[model samples]
Target: AVLTKGVTPINFKPEFADADAAEGEDTDPHAFQSVANAKIYVKNIADAFCTADAEGCDTYKANAAVYTEKLDALEGDVRTAIQSVPQEKRVVITSHDAFGYFEKAYGLTFLAPEGVSTESEPSAADVAKLVSQVKQDKAAAVFVENIVNARLIEQIASETGVKVGGTLYSDALSQPDGPASSYIDLMHNNIAQIKGAILGS
Candidate 1:
């Protein structure tokens, strides 16, 4: 693998590469900052390919432009969908913090028991704190990620008396036959699940 071979790891987007970045303060280095960063990441990859083959790079760039346009449209659609929901009603509960970037890019508030990874169990203290927060905030919904166990979220929902919302895609794409097979499908599915759960509850 290029990574194991010691190939330079470039930041897909600089904003997502810095450590000092904060949530609402500016773009966080570890999280997706905005939908526009999608274009920058694609363009950076295209530029990387050019280092080896200039001819192939041109084709990559052209294709990237087309895809970037599609991303633009997707961003607009997301904004429109989110605009329909009231601000205070945008709270959601999940088990991990992987959606920080999504919350930053979009306008939703995501509360989680674990930070960034699903490989470990969340501490009892963290779970207790989140449970308290959920009860106090009246979080609109609790959702399980495709890559995470549903037990934690289900527990939260039961304890808080909030319903379990639909599953969201994170960490990877869903199977082709599933609801979030493509990037666009993932975005649409997440927003729909969010809005449906919040509004319906």
Candidate 2:
């Protein structure tokens, strides 16, 4: 009998979060996972720049517009890439709840052991619970995250028999030479890896 102690996190939510989820009680702070929200980040930054340096307002707006266009293209690309996988196979497993916004944006389902904040490690009970969920849901792939240790995910994958599809960039970007060096590249790499894993590529 596994002790469920230390299993339930403050940020834990039901696995099947609603489309407009108040998931994690509407407190998952990784809003940048969604490109649409990311555009808002750019706009806010541009607005701050314009306020700080009125003379550079035009330049700030122009730069924000350019980045926003790039984000638009990236959103479209993400949609197209994810379209290849059938909806039923869209379930994915990752290390934590960081991908909730991503799931909310891309029509994917993400299951994780930890909540949005990864300050603590998931216990054995959490892994066991997640393992059971993986089997029950027939989750397509499991991924390690760039910001957290992969040991927990590895244990979950081993027990559930789900392949460790690839590393997903969440909470941070990779080094300059890494595949996920930028926001656009990060989305592309994540979707490509997800698609490849689910489609058996």
lDDT of 1 by residue, 63-181 (tens): 88898899899899888878888998888877545566677678888765433223445566756766887878768888997866776677667777776889887667789999989
* Model 2 residue 90 distance off true place after TM-score fit, in angstroms: 0.7
Global lDDT scores for all candidate models = 0.68, 0.76
Q: After superposition, how far is residue 143 of candidate 1 from its true place, in Å?
A: 0.9
Q: Determine which window of 10 residues in candidate 2 has minimal summed lDDT.
A: 1-10
Clashing pairs in 2: none
72: Cα error in model 2, Å: 0.7
Q: Using Cα atoms with residue i matched to residue i, what is each candidate's TM-score against the true structure?
A: 0.73, 0.78
Please give the lDDT score at residue 105 for candidate 2.
81
On lDDT, the candidate that comes out on top is 2
Instruction: List residue ranges in candidate 1 displaced over 4 A.
Output: 1-34, 114-131
